[model samples]
Target: MKLSILALASTSVIAISTAAIGQEQDEELRFGLGGAVVTQDEGYKDVGSETQFVPAIAIEYGDFRLLGPYASYTFFKTDSFELAATGMLRLDGYEQADGDIFKGMEDRDMSFDFGLEAEIDTDFGEFGLKYTQDVTNTHEGYEATLSYGLPITVEKGRIVPYIAASYASEDLTNYYYGVKANEATADRTFYQVDSATNFEVGVSSDWFFGQNHMIKADISYTSFDSSIKDSPLVDKSGTFQVLLGYVYVF
Candidate 1:
């Protein structure tokens, strides 16, 4: 079966974008749905993960936000853990049989995906959980994140600094870092699947330079464990991302 893991990977990115939008306490309720083009470096520098188109939905009631109930024809959900283990074993056997031991000795090939997130307000700020599922037949895995926001006062506007940590379950870490045969490239038919764990720490600032307008900058470090540490699939070992958007709170 051809695994649609790409769909799941893409979903993870979408979940982030969904949480990026600002929220308000006075509003009774609100809903939104959107998508973005994301560039991921799973582990390869020259060969980054595929550019994906991901979409999501969100509902907000006062201080709480739920990321989905929204659906996409492009993606689907499935069991990630079971699939990931099976994929690892398959890649390991494929490598031993082909006897082509070098770069392609592991199964690091993965896919894009779609999923959901739910959050609420607290004295500390906002807290939430996110889950994403793979859509392929080869390997499967998902990513889950927990975060909190802290608000500080500034002369010009409100500066909100947020901290979040995410875990890409064993299934996910192994799939993207796993090994398998290179039937697609006509190289060797053997490969190994590497188990991986990705952790990220970052801060974000929302500056109200003017009404309904804000400036945002986010910087984070994402690292992986296992042989994938040396794999070429990673695009950025350490990176920074900045974004600008308009936020209107009623």
Candidate 2:
């Protein structure tokens, strides 16, 4: 069906959880339920903010790690460095029912990505790198990201602020943002998207109380380059996302 905004919210949860990789997790299992409120533009003409409930999962079984919809398997690890095979759902693109701009446009489908990830946890901060391609072929594109996060301890929890840069392949950008000649109309002219990079900054926090009660939240903003900003399907240059959720640790 339509994975639209809900998928984006879930991705935000994934980002927050992934950024907290240096923190300790429950070895056996950590699962709970929570809801998040997300606001994003994606540069679409009329679409705005949205929300839904999502799972809170932090399970480390052997070399595998699960964070909400994001999953990874570590094949190699050292005291401070690890390399893993990663896979996650790419919940992007649009449905015709989403906005009027998509009336004459074909529905872009959601796809899955598979790739490799490397991470390093040091005294200063945690650094992460990932490279993924669309295995489902919905976009036939690839992406790479580099991120850094530093954790700070508060009274009963940890606050982490991270910055990341992502490079989007032309195939991926065009599939989601560009309008083709066959799908173009008088109101929407043909446009082709080129490869570009996006920058993001965000902060996440996890507060624990009574051993089982946990509160999680994150706020992030992404700035799009001309490759996406110049698209006929997009109207803005950036988008902001906010998530607030609670999970009970078992």
Candidate 3:
């Protein structure tokens, strides 16, 4: 399985997803460092709310940006529209070492995904569209996502409330949640997952101070579709993840 460079932000990669487009500024390099934590409970039968601390390292140079496991390069832009090439790592699968529920299950490997994304900003809000495919045959699948966010300028910073939906292919869904015939046990049944759509609602905020210091926090809830919920491996219907961090812009 391919390793993800970082897990500093939301596994959904929305830290860099607000506009899905980089800010329009003079060609310059920007960097920040901090630490973040995430807490999640995503339907895994035996898994409780899993939390972890990750170092946050973000870099933006000219038309390129890198944050955690997500990276993008903006090649086209306009006053209210922009397009970019993006990539991220798939960290959805689990290993046997993770828990007994996966004791005899074949390991579902992670993969790198690459795609093109477009963003549109209007008085009402921002809209982002993306289509990605797993380059590695690990899952041999593709997915598409559509998201909307409303940015409310606040004191010295901004807050964004957003909603997003992603459609995953059968291959992708099955790879992460399916139970194979040979892998099934007395308690686990052989199950196959079809294409599924998941929905998410989130709010993210940022506070700026002392010229270069910034603090950020984000919270989100994701609802899985029936296709995934029916999996014996899953026990919950939804999941929540939270992220908070501080950094000095330089």
In every candidate, how many clashes are there?
Answer: 40, 0, 0
Query: Where is the poorest 10-residue window by lDDT in model 3?
Result: 1-10
Name the better of 2 and 3 by TM-score: 3
Candidate 2 residues lying further than 4 Å off, grouped into runs, are: 1-4, 11-30, 55-59
True-structure RMSD, every candidate: 10.1, 2.8, 3.1
lDDT of 3 at 39: 67
Better of 1 and 2 by TM-score: 2
Instruction: Write the number of the candidate with greater lDDT, choosing between 1 and 3.
Output: 3
Q: Model 3 clash tally? A: 0
Task: Highest TM-score: give the candidate number.
Answer: 3
Alpha-carbon RMSD, candidate 1: 10.1
- State TM-scores per candidate: 0.49, 0.89, 0.91
Lowest summed lDDT across 10 adjacent residues in model 1 is found at: 81-90
For each candidate in the order shown, give its overall lDDT on alpha carbons.
0.43, 0.77, 0.78
- 84-139 per-residue lDDT for model 2 (tens digits): 99998887877789899899789898889999999999999999999999998799
lDDT, model 3: 0.78
